[model samples]
Structure formats: C-alpha cells, structure tokens
Target chain A: MLAWAIPTYTPAYPGYGASPALMLNVSVYVMLFMAILSLIRISVAVYTNRPVCSEEREFPEDLEGDDGFTQVGRMNLLHLARVMIPCVLLVVAIEYIGYALASFAFLMILQYLIGSRKWLQSTILSSVLVAVLYIVMRYGFGVPVPGPQVF
Target chain B: MEMIFAGLLDSISPASLMFLLVGVAVGVLIGAIPGINGPMAIALFIPITYYMTPLTAIGFLVGLNKGAFFGGAVSAVLLRTPGTPEAAATSWDGYPLTQQGKGEKALRMALYSSVAGDIISTFVLILIAAPLAAVALFMGPSEIFALISLALTVIAGIGTTSICRGLIAAGFGIAAGLIGTEPVTALPRMTFDVYQLGSGLSLIPVAIGLLAFSEILLQLERFTVKGDSEHSANVFSSKLEDRLVSFKEFFSKLKTLLRGSLIGIGVGAMPGLGAPVASFMSYDQAMKRSKNKNEFGKGSLEGIAASESANSSVVASSLIPLFVLGIPGNLAAAMLMGAFMIHGMQPGPLLFKENAQLMYGIYGSLVLASLFLLLIGRFGLRLFCKAVDIPAMVLYPIVIFTCIMGAYLGKSSMFDVGVMLTFGFIGYFMRKFDYSYVAFLIGFILAPEWERALQQVVIISENNTFMFFQRPVAMVLMAVTFFVIGRTFWVSINDSRRKKAEQAMSAEQAKNG
Candidate 1:
C-alpha cells in the first residue's frame, strides 16, 4: 500500500495546498527523516563495531513452552497454513451463503485451528454473541449493524 | 450557626433523603457488575431526573457516584480483578492482599480511604465549581487551545505502558476521530460513500468491542488449548483480616490520604484524562514520599489506601472542567453532559447564574453522596467480596451477552452489530499488536475540539500562521509538551522492559515446573 500523511487541506484554508499534496509532503518528509536517522544510527553502530540491541536473542525461543498451547517458534507453520488458507479462501467462495452462514463458517474455522472439537458449545457461544451484537447496536441505537441479508 | 442549621434542614429533606438511599443501593449493584461504573450509572440516571425534583435528581446522581466508587474498590480488593479502570491500579496491591488471606482488611482500608477522599472532594467541588466557571467565561479560543494541548501532554506522562506506542496509538486515535466529518464545513473526509460511514464510529459500541467482547473471544480460546476446568472457592471465609483497625491506624494514614486526594483533584480538573491518571499519579506520588515503597506491589496496605482515595477523588474534580468550561474530562463525564442537556440544564458558565438553587442542590447531593458511600461501604463490604467465586468459564458468556444487550439497548439497529464486531476485531488486533486503546479514545474525544480550535485560530490570525506561536500560553504548553514527551518515553521504555523481563523469568519457571 502507498503510505501517505493526510492534511486537512480545506479549500477555504489560505496557506493549505491540495489535500493530496499536503499528505504526500508530510508523509515523504517524515518517512525520509526517520529512514535517514535510523541509517545514521545503524552505520555508527556497525562502523564503530559497538554493541547493538539484538531482537532474536532476547525473544526467548521457549516462550509459552509450558503454556498448554503451541509455542510461536515451534508451531508447524505448514500445517497451520494448510488449514487456514482454504478456510479463509472458502469464505468468499460461498457467495450465495448468507452473512450469518459466513459467520458460522468463521467460527468453525477458528475453533478447528485452536484444536477444539467441542463444536456445539463453540457454535452456541459465537452465534449468541453475534445475535446480541446484531440486536443492540442495530435496533437500540438506530445504528446500522452488518449481518446476512441476501440469505 | 444559622447557616449550618438552615443548610442541614434544606439538605436532608424527606425527598432528598429518599433519593440518597435509592442512589446508594443502585450504585452498589451497578458497581458490583464489571462494565457499568459509578460515573456511567450517574449518566444513565441523568435523563430520568426530568421526572424528579432537582434536589432528588442531584441527590441520586451524587449518591450513585459515591457508592459506585466504593463498590469498585471491593471487586479490586477481593477478586483481584478491578470492576472499573481506576480500580485496576488498585489491584496492583489490593489483589495480592486478597491472595495472602487479608482480603477483608484490604476491603476495610479501601472503604475508609474511598469515604475520606469522596467527602473531601465533594466539599472541594462545592467551593470551586462556580468560581472556576466564572473564570472560564473569560477564556478565548486561544486559551482553550492551550488548555487542550496541555491536557494531551499530561496524558502522555500519565503512566502508559509504552510512550512511543502510546503516542503512535494516540495519533491513530486522533485520525479515527477525524474520519466521520470535517468539523467546520460538515464535509465528509474519509467516508467511503456509505451513508453510515459519515456518522462515524460510536464510542459505547467501540468500548464494548474493545474492553468487553474481544476479551471474551480471547478467553474462550483458552478452554480448548488448556483442556482444564477451574475449581471454585468460597467467598467470605478466612480472607477477612477480622481486625477492625483502631482510629490510630486511620489517623496515621490521614496525611497520605490527603496528599492522594490533591493529586486526584489535580488530574480530575483536566477533561479527557480521568480516574486512571489520578490513581496512577496518586499511587506513584505516595510511593515516592512513602516510607514503605518497597512493599508497594506486594500487598502494601498503604498503597491500597493511596490508590482508592485518589481514584475516587476524580469524581468531583472531573466535574469542575465539565461544569466550569463546558469540556468533558472523560468518556463518562461526556455522557453525563449529554444527559444533563436532556434535563434542560446547560452545565457551563451560565449554569450558576441561571440556576443557583439547582447548583446548590448538586453541591448538597455531592456531600450527601459521600456520606452515604461511607455508610454503605462499611456495611456492604462483606457482600461485595463474594464476586470472585465466578470462574472465567461462566462469566465470559454473560459478559458477551450483556455487551450485546448494552449496544442494542442504546440503539435498535442490527447493522451496528456488525459495527461492534468490526471494532472488536480492530480493538483485539490493536491491543494484541501493541497499540494503546486509551490513546484511540483520547483522539476521538479531542478531535472535535482541536478542529474547532484550529479553525478559530486560522480565522483570527487571518492566515498569519506564525501567530500561533505568539500566544504566551500556547508557547509554554508546547515547550512543556516536548519535555514531557521525552521524559515519559524514557521512563515508559524502562518500566515496560523490566516488566517483560520479569514475565519471561516467570514463564521459564512455569515451563520448568
């Protein structure tokens, strides 16, 4: 994505330019300033052969080792990827399916990824939460909440 | 003698007395719940006040605020989970005391400290609100702009978990507030042409999304991964310290309590920076000046006293800016302002002159509310300590349900349901990915004010951009802001890194076990 700063360039504002111009000007300035500052600091550290902050060492590879769930570094990214890729992709594939159905699909995928077979409980809980969210903001506050309409 | 006699009669009429009792009862129950707080409880009742006398309505609001203040401390002390954000800081020391089997004693100190702070601040609110409002009448847009800038600076220093992340999060939050409409011309800035996008995001739904719903979602994931059930415990057995401390102990904390109260008052005076700042500042100041700083996180009784007193102290002081300057100091106060407008009373500079008796009613209510807080807090301490019995399993579903109901109750739209989930998703990702939710809130609150201020500044200067620096207050604020940001970043980075290191060590120990 193209990064930009957004300036409030109101037509009435005299000193302000076009909205896009101001945004580009600010973003470019900040991005360049930060990049140069970081480069200078990095060069100084490397050229001087000085101590630097090391991220990988401090991250503790065994974090969540005792945490009943999978550790971040050790999780089989391939297996996890195999499961998530299709489930996420399938969401858009079912174009005729309603929003509520899509929501159900999302819950099923999340539950399975987390290694839960307690389908009934997960379905009940997720459905109720979605329904309440549907009723409250949509009906009570005159706020338009999203849900399955075509189904 | 005449003033005391007359004031007592006027303050304690049958009608006022009835309202106070009802307010206290409602306060304790609402406070017992996790989401509804003292200020919010008052705000909810503000609209209903149209049906009652001013004295009764004010009495109810004040009494509720007082009761909720004490009620929140109870959950913090006994459950180790604070019912409100202010009480969250209290749990730093208060919860440890509970785990160490002194929950009852911690509850007592919290009640005593809360009562002491509320009474002192109520009196302070009475004497200061009108005079401050009068002074505020003379402030032009320039002064308001400076004041807003100073508030933003102060918020940066108010103990965020990380200064850089907090600042970035705050910037993002301001941007979020900018999304709905341009303040001057009502032109839509960022709405993608959807009719609903122009209305912007609703705060309550966003709060429900961030604080309530997403938290439940995360909690549910633990059930499968861990595959272990929790064992429930009894509520009010041995945790009570059984010793009603002597007046000597109370008197010993008097100075500390007063110091904490002043910190609370100062933080409360600034709108948009509410009780959390007051509590943190008071607790930090107390630790700095205390003889027992080493015992702060390890069930220190004095720490509990300082945090509770200062946190509740914000209730009245926060009202000062709201009434005097027509600026909301926090989300709860902003909601309260909306409710007041519903009651046909404009709470600003004109409030005192236009409605003196109503103002007096408010003052009387404040004093009465604090008094009732002490009475109910002392008696209801035992009952409140029982909430910890709820295991995470059953509570998550109920919380999720209530969050949905609260959103629906305010507006009966289904699309807002999707809005809630979307924000909930955003909130979860932000917090999970290291963004400050409170900074986002601050951005939302100050967006309109900044826009209006900038517009006025532009018009007044007639395009002389340099004129912004010419104002003395603005320049001083800007300078102080730079210094505050630098100092805040240094301390925040150190504190957070230390906490992370400590957590890492604890995880290693657990893994070994």
Candidate 2:
C-alpha cells in the first residue's frame, strides 16, 4: 500500500559498521539535548515576533558585555588582519619553544598588546610566576621540565 | 580539637602562609583569564606540588581554587564578558553598572561580596562538615545515593527557565556520565575501541572550548565593534567614597544578602551544580523577593551583591560534600580530589581518621584564603580596572590562544590541542544559537561518573527499571523532579506570552509616537 518505502540502511564506510543514529539517547541527554531545546524555544520566539516597523527602533548604544562591560567597537579590517596573521604563525611555532617558554613569551606580548605600560612590573611578575612553576614541576613532580638548552 | 589546633598552627607557619597567599593570587589570575578554570589550575599545580610537603601543596591549591572564584568578576565587570561561566550571572547586573559609569563601585561590591561570602561559608563548612561526616560514618550506599538524589533535587531547583529544559539538561548530564568503561562491569559503553575515548572527555578542555573559545568566535562577528567607556568612567570623586547609596540604605538590604546566602549554600552543596547556578538562583530569588523587582538588571547594587556573594559562598559549600562524602560537588572540586589523591591522601571516611590534622589544616587554610581574597581584591582594584581597557581586537585572539594552550597542557599532545580548538569553534556556534554550554560542561565532567552510576544502578536493579522508583528517597527525588519540570515549563510558557505582550504594546506605542 506504501508507494514510497524507506531504505533501512544508509550504508557505512570502510572501517565502520552499521551506523547507529548520531544520537542514541546517550548523546541526546547529556548536553546536546539542552542546547536543542533552548534553540527551539528561542528560535520560535525570534521567528514569531513581528518587526515593530519603527525607524527609530535600534539596539541600545549603551548596552554592555563584561570583561570590563563597556561597549567595545568592532575591529577594522587592518586590525583584524594584524592579529590573525601572527596568531596563525604562533600556532606553527608553539611547539618549538616548549610550553613554559611559549607561555612566557605569549603572556608578555599579550600584556603589551593589551596596553599595559608597566613592562618592568609585568616582566618581574611573569618571571616570578614562571620560576615558581619551574621549581614546582622540576622538584615537586619530578617532571624533566624542558629548560632552554645549555649548548 | 587537639589535631585541629596543631593543624592551624602548622598552616600558620611562614612557608604555609606564603603558599596560601601565592595560591590565592595564582587562583584568581588563572580563574580570571578566559578559558582557564579552577580545576585545571589545581591539576596544573598538583604536579608542581609534589616536592612540597602536603601541607603546603594542599594549602596552596585550596587557596588557589578559592581565589579563582573572585578573579573572574574583574573580567566580568569591565568587559561585560564573564571570564568564567560562574561570572556570567554577575555580568547581567554588573555590566549594567559599568555602563552607568559605576564600574569601580561594581567591582568593589563584587570583591567585598566574594570575600565576605567565602569567609562566612568556610566557617560554616567547618562547623557543619565535621559533625555531619561523623554522623554519616554509619551510612551505606543506599543513604549516599539518597543524599545525592536530594542534592541533585536541590540543584535541579536552581534555574528559573523552562523546567523541561533543566530536567533535560540534568538527564543529559546523567546520560553523559553514562559513557566509557563501566565501573561495576569494566565493559565499555560506547568507546568504539579508541584509547582517548576510553578515559572520556576531560572538563578542562571542554570548559576552555565552551566558555573561552566559543566566546571568541561570537566576538569575531563584531571584531571591530568598539564603544567608548561611559562619558565619565573616571567620574571618581563622589562614587569613589561609595556615595551612591547611603549607609542607612546599605544596612536595610541585609535581609536580601542573608536570603541569597541561604539559596547559594543549598544549591552549592548539591553535586554537579556549581557557582553559576548558585549566582543565578540567588539573583532570581532577590528579584522575586524585592519590593522593586525591576531594580534587578537596572544597576541595582543589591542585585550585584546577591549574585556575587552567592557564587563565592558556593565555592565553600561545594567542599562540604567533597570533604564529608568524598563526592565532588563539581568539576573543580573533582580535580582537587585528584590532586589530593596524587599527594597520597584519599579524601573519604578513612581520610577523617587517618588525617584528622590534615583536615583541620584545610579548614584553617580556607579561612586564610578568603581573608587574602578580601585583601588582594580590594587593594588591587585599580590594576584589575585596567582590564576594562583591552580592545576586543587584541583580547579575543589572546583568549583563543590561551584556550589552545590550556588544551595542549592537558595531554601535552598536539592532537588534544587540535581537539580543543575544534570544540572551541563548535562551542562558538553553540553559543550563537543559545546552546547549553553548561550542559556540555556537565556532560564532559561527569561522563565517566554518570556512566559508572548508571551501570551500578542497572546491575543493582538487575535491569529492573522499577528499582529506580522503588526506593523512598528516590521516589521523593523523582516527585520533586516532576514538580520542577512542571513548574519550569509553566513559567517559560508564561514568559513567552508576557514577552509577546510587551512587544505588541511597544510596537503600538511606537506607531502612535
């Protein structure tokens, strides 16, 4: 009686078996379910609400988000490019310096980029922090911390 | 009592004090940074603490965890961007104050609240836990399970949103916990034979991806969006003295503070739920109980105070279950347990007998840590204020990089690092679409435990589904569960209607105007 019958198998790729659904009550209940539910609720609201059709209506200019909560401007193309290039390069270079070295360099640079004028203060604090971590890792945990080679 | 005095004396030593102060400072900084969190900070420090005496190491990590809770507020107040998920509630009201040229005052309130609440709760934790643990020594798994159920019930009551969504979130959390090797059976649930999946997803990477990397992606859309600080961010003279509210006005709000504290402790003591829930629940309660509900989200100091104190107090409350029952209240406490274990101290019933002095040391250290939090957060306010100045152009990449680095630290594997970044990008999309990143975090952190618990239940129940309903405690918990779900759905429905009405009224008014 059914003209359009569905196939049972979607077929699996090599090294795979009959694929279970992407959700198996396992993935659905943990976190993805909440997201799905919220998305549905919010989306229905957004879709059903009609535009007011008022020219003066706009997002409040004074609204804030917190790291400091003041309104932050969008980055110019140049500024965005400036950060993106170095970020990509840093990913490639991250392994060569070892974790501690990479952290020290990265944090110092970040402090500057964030407009910290207390270079000496940051350097001293960073040095102390790294030193404390170094001692802890080497002596406390006995991990052979990768110090810069003497050679 | 003898051991307690000795432990206090030991912790008061110069070495211990140094470790405690440094730990709190380190905790705040690590917690303040986007993506990094309390648990990961503790884990990272655990290895480094091996050489130190357990007193120093434990002292330091405890102080550090406490410190991180407050640190996130600095980033939350200035940027309107919470540095940690716990600070998200703080941002709702805290950020509004910043826009009103009251950033300094807002930050000060958060600082004082975090310190005061944390100190008060530590004393409460000490007084309550010792006696409770002693009493609970005779308890069996049946009682433990019941307690956990009650705790979860309390936690489930936190969110004011749709009850279905909250239950769905908790169910998802339970299901997420039900993965990997079954503890009772040692059989894999759905590992697919992968080595990494065998251990399951770690909380640190998940938090970094969800809170930090995801935020970076969201911010990327408006990477160039900049707003000047309020016309007078430097308008310091009158408000500098905290003249916005009279002293008589401040004393009158004590009732709200106490009520929020009660809600915070109740939500916090329950496992799985953590600071964010406590803060939000407290904030919600404050609004409901207030003579002026609209004052919330409108630069109300009481709103800020309630949320901030509730979150910080939850930190101490979280330790109650940890110290008494050996069940961690949340991810951060779980990692702290791991650190304690690595130090040759298993924190459970035996822990009280074998290491009573050490227990007292922890109690003493928590008090000291809260004191330091108050001292540092107040005096260091000006330094933290500068955080408000960082441009999104520079800050976003740094946050993203920190997340990547944090993920790499987890396994020292570039593979895991890539996994962190992948999740970060996905997490970004999740946030844009109003996804429950908190659910994801709960899932990742509790996956192994949830798996173990379900397997235990399945085996104990002999696959008899009715067993879950058979126990009186479980029955009560289930009843409460249903009530919560029904209430939440009802509220959400009402909320949607109310919002619709407001929008229609606004539209009509606009047309007339």
Candidate 3:
C-alpha cells in the first residue's frame, strides 16, 4: 500500500534524450532496499528469539507508556490527532479564509485545545499576534499576506 | 596588508556597525526563544536584507548567527530548554547550574566562550579560506562528487543512532529533492502531475516546517500536560545577581574553551557535520578528560564552556566550505549563500580573485561581528533571560503564525505553506521514530549538487559506471563510505549484544532472588 504512493521513475517524457529520472530511480530504489533490509533484520531478530524492535532502552521510565522505536503506544495516536489535525485544518483554512484570519483562528483554537484556561487572555494575544504579523508582512516588508484581492 | 586595512575600514562604517549590532540583538532574542533557531531566523530576515548593502547585509547575518549561538545557551541554562539543538548539550550542565542558582554564571561563561571561539574560528576562516579555495579550484566534478559522497556517509554515520535509519532518512530526503522537473530534461519526475510540485519544494518552507512547526507541535504536547504549564511559569524567576559569575571564574575555563574551539573548527570545516554535533562531541571530550568527571551534568562550568565554545566556533568556521567551494556546510550557511546570490556575489575561487576587496571586507565584518556579539550578548543577557519566562502558550502560537507567514513570504505561494505543513508532519514522525532529520535535511540540500556532479561524471566517463573506481579520490571516498557504514553497523551489533547479555544477567539475578 505504502509502496504505491512512493513515486518511481516513470520515464514519462520519452523524447527528452537521456532518462531524466536516473537520480530519482537511484533514490527510490535505495529507500526501498533499506526498508526491505530493515524488515528482514526485524523478522530475523523476532524469529531468533532476540527481538530487537523493543522500546525498552530507547525511552526513559516517564516515557515508557508512550511510543518509542517500533512500539505504537496510544500517546502517538493522541499526539498525531492533537497536533496534525489542527495543522492540516490550518493549511486548508488559509486557502479559504486567508492567512491572518486563519492564523488567529488557529492560534486561539490551539491555545484552547492545549488547555489554556484564560480564554480572554488567549484571544487577545492571538488577535494581537495575527494583527502584528499581518502589518509587518503585508505593509512593512511588502510581502503579500494571503487575503482578499481588494486588500 | 593594505587590502586588509582597507577592508577593516570598510566594515567599520557607521551603517555597517549599526546593522551588525541590530543583527546580534535580533539574533539573540530569536535564539533565546524556544522553537526558533538561527536558520529560521536568518530565513525570516533574508528578505529584509535585500535592501541593504552587501557588506552590511552579510555582516548583519553573520552577527546574527554568532549571537544566536550564545543566545541558545541562555534558554538552555535558565529553562532546561535548548532554543536550538546545538544547545542541547549545554543544557546537560547548564540547567543544573541554574538549579544551583548559578544561571547567570553559566550565561556569562557561555558569552565569554562564545566570543573567544568566534574570534579564533573567524581568524582561522580568514587564514585558510583562500588557500582552501585555491586547492579546491583544481578539483573536477568527479572529485567534488566524491567529497560530497563522503560527507553524506559521514553525516549518515554520526547523525543518527542507527545506520539503517540514517540511510533511510537520507534516501527519503534525496527522493524528496528529486521531485519536480528534472534539471536536464525539464521533465517532472516525481511531481505526480501536481503543478506546484513541478517547481520543486523551496528550501524555506521545508526548513521552516521541519525545524519550527514540528517544534511547535512538540511543545504543544508538553503544554497539554497539566504540570508543564505551571513549570513554565516558574522558570527563571530567581534573582539575577545570585547566579552571576566573576571574570576570574570564567577565565579559569579557558583551556576547556580552547579545546572546544579546536574541535568546532575541525568539524565546521567539514562539509556536513554541524554545530550540534561539534557541541556534543566537545562536551563528551570534556567529560572524558575532566579530573572531576562526576561534575559533568551536575553544574560543571567546564561543560557549559565546552558546548558554548564549540557551537559558537562552528558559526564562523562553517563558512569556510561555503565561501571557498560555494557549498554550504549547513542550513544556516545555505541561507547565507542565498543572501550572497541575492546580492550578486557568487562564492568560489574566482570570488577571491575578482572580489578581493569585498572578500576582505567580509572578513573584517566577521571579526567586527564577533566583537558586536560579545558586546550585545553581555548587556542583553538579562533581557534575553526574561524570554524564558514567557508562557509557551503565548510564545508558540506567535511562532507558528510567524512560521506560516515566513513560508508565504518566501515565494508568495500557498503551495509552499502546504509544503511546510506536510514537512512539519513528516518531521514530527521522524523525531518520534528517532530518525536523524539533520541527515535528511543535508541530503535534501545536497541532492541537486549530487545529481549535477553525478551527471557530469557519467558524461565524462562516457556512460562507464565503473569509471569512478578508477579515480583515486573517488575510490578512496567510496572505500571510506563503506568503512563508516560497516563500523556503524558493527558498533550497533556489539551494543545490542551487550544489552542482551546484561538483560540476561539481570534476569538470572532476579530468578535467584
């Protein structure tokens, strides 16, 4: 399933003299080879009764319940959902709402989600940050902040 | 001598001096803030430097790099949070010193050592860059490819805990770099027909996402923990003078500083090994050689000196490869190269001959910047120390916003923002899996050069794949690469064996009990 998503050298543009995908092939093949090698090593280790995929040494006691090495603890999932979901949403939101508004929304929601109890304080700070960033990027630096064409 | 003097005068202009000071101040503030680093800071400021003179602009950036090195130590000491990865080793002893109410002393030691290291390494750069460039001028594409390959191997070996993971990360990075249109054919290889991907991923977004946004996510995880919020509030709340170190005390650690500076210079001159590696290596060396070995990781001043000096020295010496060969040693140097290109200055052997005055001026600026870093760092320590007290909730969100804005500012592309977010997720997973993101980043950065050189080599050899083996330098590098990979694997195997044996012995003891 994962391999399908990994881009391979397709030789798409045949008319262009030499294959332009040479280095691409080199990189993809090397990665695929390493992944296979790792899989084999792990299989051998498990089969030989000396499993090397254990997280025992990689993590400390405090992090023992969390994922390390090959361990897929619950915390990894929680963290992924907590962090990545918002980031992904922010990326999507920026295209629709614009950078300033999306950033303000993102910051406030992030703060709230992270357990910031001072809602008013978080709102003010997030608003101010968004405004300041908008001003600096849009006006001061002349870098266009993604917004309505009128702006 | 006359050109040196002229260059010195050129660098000391009021406008240049002002920019240098401003750069140091800005760099220190950014560096002292957790989740921000020199490369990100430089990337953010590169657009601003477009309007300034080359001398003033490069000087300001160099000063920023130097100041950030010391500034990173500030957060490491006072908050046990390294503002940059290079400061990770400093936090080992620095945080202990802070716990013992010697935070100011640690900061002062970091400042002095940073300045000393910067001075020595800047002088070393001045002395060796032209000569190295002269030597490098004679090298062919094959030789360059060999050198770059050696760099990749060394980075893969030293940058991660496992050789497999490191190589895997490098492969992925190279693959990522190969996305977009192939340089020679102008045909897209891995873009999957996405128009934005056809232009290739810009370095700014990828870097900002990897270093900054991933860090923001990590910090968010910490902030979610109930105890961590209260802990952040209380950080660096003690009286300032109680933690101060005297001049005599700082001078006592000169030997350690010198040793670290040498190590940093050596590592920095190498193409791929960076400040974080040098700092940790120096700290390890210091711990091994110390009479009071037990004092390490327990408020030892020597530990702070070792890490601070080595990391700071890397700032100046890392430029040697960049200036002489036009090949940046690290991300920060790559940004500086971008600045150079923006200013119409190409760095290489011909640059020394064609732009001697400018080169000398840059050398002068480096020395002046070191002085500025010391001055700004000494006075601004108290101000930056307060940055540790800022709530992560307030700080990180603003950083996240800035990161997004910075990415957009790079090429004014929403596509870059998406790239940044994607890499942020990738970086987060990479960290969790204990893969070396540094090696990955270096691989991505070097991939274009690698591809170019490889293509050149192929053409020169008339498609003979084995021709590289005939070239002495290429053969030597290939041999070294194999040796390094083999050694790393062997070490891992031995380590696992020892660990298993110990586990078995412990099990037996438990059984007996």
Candidate 4:
C-alpha cells in the first residue's frame, strides 16, 4: 500500500517580504513527502501484524517483558539526567568562572557523576587535564578560550 | 611535477610531520578503545585545526583516518571485540586466531594488509580524482541537481534498514539546512528573528553534537542499561615465529590482498556503501575462493588480510567522490569536507586547478600516513591494546569536555554551544529511532549546493519543471532516482508480506504441535 500527499506549510512569519521562500517551500515539500511515506510504513506495519516500527523480535518469549522495558527506560532517563544536568551546570559555570576554573570544576563534577567516588583523585586528574588543555588551546593553538564576563 | 615536489616537501616538513604523527597516534588509541571511532575523533579535533596550517591539519586528519582502520583490527584480534564496525569481520577469524595462540600472527597480517591496501588506493586516488574533477566541472546546474537528487535517493534508500526513516531523516536535514536564509533572495526564512541564526548553524557544532555528544549519551545509556563488560587484551603467544610474518609469507597472499583492495575501491567509491560492507564482501570472497575454506573461521591469515585490507583501503577510495565531485561518499568523508571548508578551501575541480600543490601535498601525506600506520602498528601494538582497557567512566566525561570546547571554538559564541547541545538531543532520538544519521549529514552537507543548483536550473529552464527532458543526463539521473526509490518500496512491501506469511505458518505449526 503506497500513497503520496503534500502538506501545506504556512511560514512562521508570512509577512516578512515580497520575495518568495522557494527553498523553504521545497524543503516543506520534501518533508511532506517523508510524512506520507512514514504514514504508509506505519499502515503497512499494522496491516502486516507487526508492531509499529518496533525493533523487538516476534516471539514474546524472546522479548523483554513490560517490566524490563520500564526498568530500561528508567535507567536511560537516570543516565541522561546524570550526564545532561552536569553538562548544563558546566556550561553555566564556564559562563561565570572562565575556562580554566570552569573546566576544572566541570571535569571534576562530571567524573564524580560518572562514578568517581574519590574526590581528591578526580580533582588532581581534572586539574592536570584542564591545565594541559588550556595550555594547548590557548597558548599552543591560539584559540580564544572563554573568559568570565565582568558584568 | 614541480608542484608535486613542492607538495611533497611541504608534507615532509617538521610541523606537518609532527601533527600527522600525533593524529595517527590519537586515532589508533581512539580506534582501539571500544565505543569510539575515527569520525568521533575527527569531529572533536577539527576545531583544534583552526590554528594549524591547511596542509598540516588535513595531513593530520588523514593520518588519523588511516590509523583508525588498522587500530580497529587490533582490538578485533586480541579481544574479539571490533572497535569499529568496519572491523566486525576481522573479529571472526582474528578471535579464532587468538584462541589458537596465533594472535600476533593475525595482528601482523592485518597491519601488512592494511598498509598495502591503503597505499594502493592512495595511488588510485592520485590517478583518478583530477580527471574526474575535470569531467565534473563541465556538468550543468540541472545535471548537477539531478545527480545530487540521485545520490540522496541512493543514500536514503540503501543506507538505512528502513527507507522511510532514512528519507525522513534526510527531509529533517534539508529543513534544518534551510534554517538561516534563502540564498538567492537573502531573505530570512526559518530564522524566527534569532539574529545569531541570521547565518546558518555552524558545521562544527552540529557535527560535534551529532557524532561526539550523541555517541557519549548512547554510551552512557549503554553503561546504565547493561553494565560495561570489560574485555582484557592479552596476547596468547610470545614466540618470535608467531609474532612476525616473513616476506615470502606476506607475498604469498598477493592475490587475496589485491582482490580485497579492488572490492574495497569499488564499494567505497559509491555514496552509501562503506567500509563495513566492503570488508565483509572481501572476506566472503576470500572464504569462497580459498582451497581451505574450512580453515576460514578457525584462524586463517587470508581472512584477516581480506577484512583488514578492504576496510583500510576504503579510507582513500571513499575520498574519490569527495575530491572529484565535492560529494562525500561516507560520514568520515563528509567530516573531511567540513574540515576542508573550515580551512578555507572548497573541494572539487577548482581544487585541482587552484590548489594543485595542496592536492599533491595531501596525496604525499596519505602515502606517508600508510607508512606511519605500518611503523606504528608494528611497534605500538601493545600500547594500543592497553588503550582498549580504558574505563568508559573515565572516557565519556572527558569526551564531553572536548566536545564542549570544540563547539565553543567554532565561532566563540556560546550560542553555538547551545546549538550543539540541542543537536545532541536530536541526534540521540534519531539514533533511538533507527534513522540514518549518515543520510541526514550528507543531506545537510549537500543542501546549499543543491539549493544553488536547483535555483540555476529554475532560471535556466524558465520555470519549466519538466525541463529535465531537454537534458538527457538529468533525465536519466532523475529516472534512476525514481526507479531506485520504487524498487526499494517494492522490495520492502514484498519482504513484509513474506514475513507475515512465514509468521502465520509458524504459528500454525506451533498450534498443531
């Protein structure tokens, strides 16, 4: 079962100018084509008695149970939070504290979050890593490392 | 000839040599480590190249690319875990050899074959890319547009398990690619009044996000969901005979080596088929042709040669399209394209004419890199084996820091850092959904050129959408796109129906039992 359809895309700002958005229109057209193709794929999957694009095997016995799925989902979310929260904080730190101090703190925090329970060990390692990186990036390579804003 | 000599001289300069050596070492270390590969390393290091000379930077990256291929086989041989997908077939015979205490023999054969393949294919690149670029220079905009369309169709249809997902990923890429402004009119289209986005998203941020950051997230999830299963990389033999291959023994497999290189070049030149495919194909051919086929999975030197040679050769042959037509044949090549553009040189026919010296310099560096691979792989094998033992907990966090630094260095804008984070999440979801990120990236890389060619076609055709009929090449390419897409859909539908029938039959048989 195959089908083709074009979805109308209203521009975010319609009154920008008199010039046509030829590129955007073509992009939208391609996206619409993709949408139609996806719809067909979903429909065929359902009709064929397959799960909707599920990567799971057919045999229930071979599959991870609902509980397993929930546990995996929970673990993934936990892992993501562990990584992303520290990442966001690190970026915020870099904004206020400059590259050297921010990088040292960020690496220490990240190493801890990734399961380094030894604070002194992680701090020493992080400091050395940061110093090396700062020297290479700032002095050796001449790329501008971010400095704290005075304001 | 003088240009070639000058290029060779430049490649052999102290600074270039230093960077290339470092690139290869880092590449090998990364490739030997599980859950990291060449593309990630290249993406992370690209921003650092902002300060280096063009020849040095590119030579460094090329060395990285070459070293990673051989490095991947190290883990495959010693640990039974392929560090890169391209080395998946290597693990088959390599692990068996390890079990038989011939791991050193397997490693040496892999190194020799890899260098041989890389050197041969590098020569092939020198022989072909210029003439092909000259031919590509004559292509009209309409034909170019049609060719890009055909390339995208093939990549979307063949690159992923699901054609719909691949095409949708490409569509999303095109949408993202159109975010900044319309090229012809210079009118902002999807910027939503974010002045920072008046210029399109930077390549470094997006690439770092997609290739490096997302991979980190995936690795984190992998660790969380399934605890890391660490493999020890211990060679089973210390015998001199087992550690070294004689010249006569290496030369005995010349047929297998040459055949693998040829298969690699053929497959690697295509847009979607990549090193993994070439390696597996070469391995299968070697197995089929060998008189002692039964020995293949039980530690055959020919198997290692076939797999390693083909995968390593792909590093250079995959550059053929990128150098000749400005179309990257794979993800690594695409990243290289981004690097080229970052260095203020566009790849294509103009590169051959305008940067002939640079081109020859790059070729010289590639050959040099192969020799470096041989030297490094021979001497530093144990060091790289130890690299595989680096804990994920230590590695992932450090990778994140580098990614952040890489993103920030692109434009010195914290905004690009935000962009990188956003794309990181997008890349995570894209991977979860089995979309072809390769297709997405290629689409993104080619989007500007595609739009320009399309605009030219429109103006040349006077708004006639069917103007393809006037250009035979364009018409044929378009037809091929349609035909391939149609065939892919047809095959997919038939496969689904067959699976459904088989499932029903199996259920019936189970019920009867």
Q: Give the per-residue lDDT digits (tens) of candidate 1, residues B1-513.
A: 444454456668888888888888678766755545765565345534545676576667767776777777767766665667789878888778767666677777888888788778878887888888888777666767766666555553332444554555555555665666555556665565656657665555565565555554444433433353443122334522343545777788888899989888887887656887788888888899988789999988788889989988888888888788666676556555544654666567778777666677667767777877777767776665554445444354445445544543444444445565666667655655445565556555565566566567767877576765778777776677677767875775576567657767888999999
Stretches > 4 Å off in candidate 4: A1-20, A44-50, A53-72, A149-151
Could you give candidate 2's per-residue lDDT for residues B1-513 as a string of tens digits? 799899899889899999999998877776665445676566445544655788888889888888888878866776666767788878787777877777777777787778767877887888898887887676544445545544443444333233444445445445444444445434454555556756555544555555555555545544334432321243233554552444555566677667767777887787767888888988888888888888788778788778888888888898888888776777667667656765777565657788999888878888888888888776776665564455444455445555554555545455555555656655554443333455445444444433434445655666676766666765675576567546656776677677767878998999999
Cα miss at B482, model 2 (Å)?
Answer: 3.8
lDDT of each: 0.62, 0.62, 0.78, 0.81
Residues B163-236 of candidate 4: C-alpha lDDT, one tens digit per residue: 88788888777767766766666766567668888788888899889888988888777675566566764765
Candidate closest to the true structure, highest DockQ? 3
Q: For candidate 4, what is the DockQ-based docking class? A: acceptable
Taking chain A of candidate 2, what TM-score results? 0.46
The DockQ for candidate 2, computed on C-alphas, is 0.11
Q: In lDDT terms, how accurate is model 4?
A: 0.81
lDDT of 4 at B160: 62
A best-first ranking of the candidates according to their DockQ comes to 3, 4, 2, 1
Q: Best candidate per lDDT, number?
A: 4
Greater-lDDT candidate between 3 and 4 = 4
Q: List TM-scores for all candidates, in order.
A: 0.68, 0.67, 0.88, 0.93
Clashing residue pairs in candidate 4 (N, C-alpha, C atoms within 3 angstroms): none
Model 3 vs. true fold: TM: 0.88
Query: Whose DockQ is higher: candidate 2's or candidate 3's?
Result: 3
Worst lDDT window (10 residues) for model 3 chain B? B226-235
lDDT of 1 by residue, A27-93 (tens): 2353355346546755775687643222232123324533222243323234334333433343343
